[model samples]
Target: MPSVNAPGLKRRKNRDGTERLYWAAPKSALAAGFPNRIVRLHFSAHDPAQHPLIEAACKRLEAEALEWTAGRRETRSAFDGTIASLVRQYQTDMASPYREVKWNTQRTYDQVLGVIEKAFGKRSLAALGISDFRRWYDEAKKPKAPGGSERVRKAHGIISMMRRMFAYGVTAELQECGRLLTILEKARFKQPGRRRQKLESHHVEAFIAKALDAGRQSLALGTALQFETTMRQRDVIGEWEPIPVAESAGGIVLGARRWVRGLTWADISDAFVVMKVTTKTGSEVAHDLTLCPLVMDLLARVPADRRIGPLIVDETAGRPYAEHAYAREWRLVARAAGIPDSVWNMDARAGGISEADDAGADLDAIRSAAGHSQASTTVRYVRGTIGKSRKVAELRKAHRNKS
Candidate 1:
């Protein structure tokens, strides 16, 4: 909030043609706890008109900064403690190496940030107490999800992130911030059930056919690739490209470059090929590309020049397709096919494994295909949602087939 042109400011021009602004707080001012730092001005020193503006900024900083620094850091008022401001301050440290976050985790944080801003962005952090959090939890309704357990979870995450931010504020030596988390104890969270979005093999065939018929060749192929390889959407979403073939010490190297987690076009070019896929749990599975006729056929429909590019791409725009576009395309196809539009393209992978279960594939085989570190996790995917009888029938079919 303090400007570079504040009192006692000095300017320097560097060989790189950019200007720098530096101010030394009088030692007496520093003793009073003024935040002393250098400010690098992005403007060129050659600009003569900026001098007066710079001097005025320094004077204002000199005058206004003393009030904040003259005493101990004071508690921020509620109106001043806007969630947006809190998030900005928190993110300054989060971007620091000591607090770096993963890409996927950062995406979740961004989503939560929007929810917080919508609910209480303008509210002061210090003014909020137990009562306010309770009220937010009871009233939190996501724009798209109005009245479901999912809505409750979204509210829970928003409050949790607020609590996390306050914890960071406390770590930054702001007083009374950590105590505010106690207010969130009344916020209830939903215990989510096992996910049940899956498809049978026949259903997958129908979905792909309809998707292709709808003129979304890339979407159709991408969905089939997920099912055929049982890959997580991240790994399957246009990541696969052609790699140069060559002989290596151990065997054939699949590509000119290697990705520990990425697949190549060559990996799926044949009836069965060895390729490794990694999942969210940080484990990798080698897929022997079999049962992939549908995926291969869809690939053949793509233009030849684009074949070496991503498996799924926005060919009209000459770029990769957005994740939401994949789901939106699937919804269009589903609606046209008379299937539930609630089905997600992500469910195609689950369909592959569940179909494997129905077709009497070994649990370990399914587990390996799905790239789960723990086989028990794969077992959970096969759990029947509605009734035990459904699972019983599948087991009975496997038994009958063996006889």
Candidate 2:
């Protein structure tokens, strides 16, 4: 038998002496979302007759890999009218809702889009029906473990992304997508329950104590800042975004990661007032740290030399923690403080909003404090705690007695 001339081909031998073949894609093929970095060539390894087929398959896959690497996959002849194509169109189309979202939000949408493409990329959009989607939903909603909680949120997110994609297809005048959207409108799915957990003062104190003890002063201060200011975690922790093609003049670049501005010392006035433009709403919000003793005390403890850059710097990286890293570190500290996993770093803002409601602050004031453009948006985060209800009851009784 002669050696085959197929590149990237590997053969593994079994105990029974039969061999299995695989084509390993180059590392760069990851940009194309290549599965497990390899494609199985279903040919008998001992058969010389299979060599030509194996070589052909390898060449074709390699060409596709190169096409993806050059970023020309969308423009290539392979742009069939599949859900995958729709995903590509929805993502790149400037008028699509995907483009309207903030950078952090787009990142999440990309993850769900990847899931869509991987699962249904080859499936024809015209053939899809409510039954197919229901089956997909069932598969997506399954628990990761045998008895673990169902992934209701994950399932809902996938369906939401699919709906958005189909809606975009309708905007683009795709007949199949419009039909799918119409069919989906009548379909029923289980909705995830709204999260009511809020980080309370005790959780904040415990987190701060744990963070400080762990030598994570920045994490401690960041927590206090978010809780006191009622700012989103993204606004407090900041985020790394890709440098756009247009211009690269602004934003701090560390290695390949471009840092969007988070809460910086420059944003804080000498009088301990924070004036910041939030990432989500782009709303400028001002808060007096002097009124928040925890924030002020934490600020005072920071030496002048270290207070020059971003307000919350990861001690380990000497810069802002990536969103995942921040969440992970926060979870560790929160767990150390005996805070339940249900309460998240994001809940700090909710906790602050709820605290404001409990403190007898007007709805308008709470909304303003939250930097929300609408009272309805602020209302979502404000949990009706026992303290707020008790205050309302006391006020009602006092008014009755006076009457």
Regions more than 4 Å wrong, model 2: 1-79, 245-251, 395-403
Query: What TM-scores do the predictions have?
Result: 0.61, 0.76
Local distance difference test scores for all models = 0.62, 0.82
lDDT of 1 by residue, 287-380 (tens): 6545578866776666666546445665454445543666666777777766665566677777777777766677887887788877888877
Candidate 1 residue pairs in backbone clash: 5-57, 5-58, 6-58, 7-58, 78-124
Model 2: per-residue Cα lDDT over 236-308, one tens digit each: 8788887767866466676656887688889889888888888778888889999998898899898898778
Scored by lDDT, the top model is 2
Model 1 segments beyond 4 Å from truth?
A: 1-85, 94-99, 102-108, 121-129, 142-150, 166-174, 181-187, 191-194, 239-263, 266-271, 274-282, 296-307, 358-365, 374-380, 383-403
Clashing pairs in 2: none
Total backbone clashes of candidate 2, pairs 3 or more residues apart or in separate chains: 0
Please state the error at residue 391 of candidate 2 in Å.
Answer: 4.5
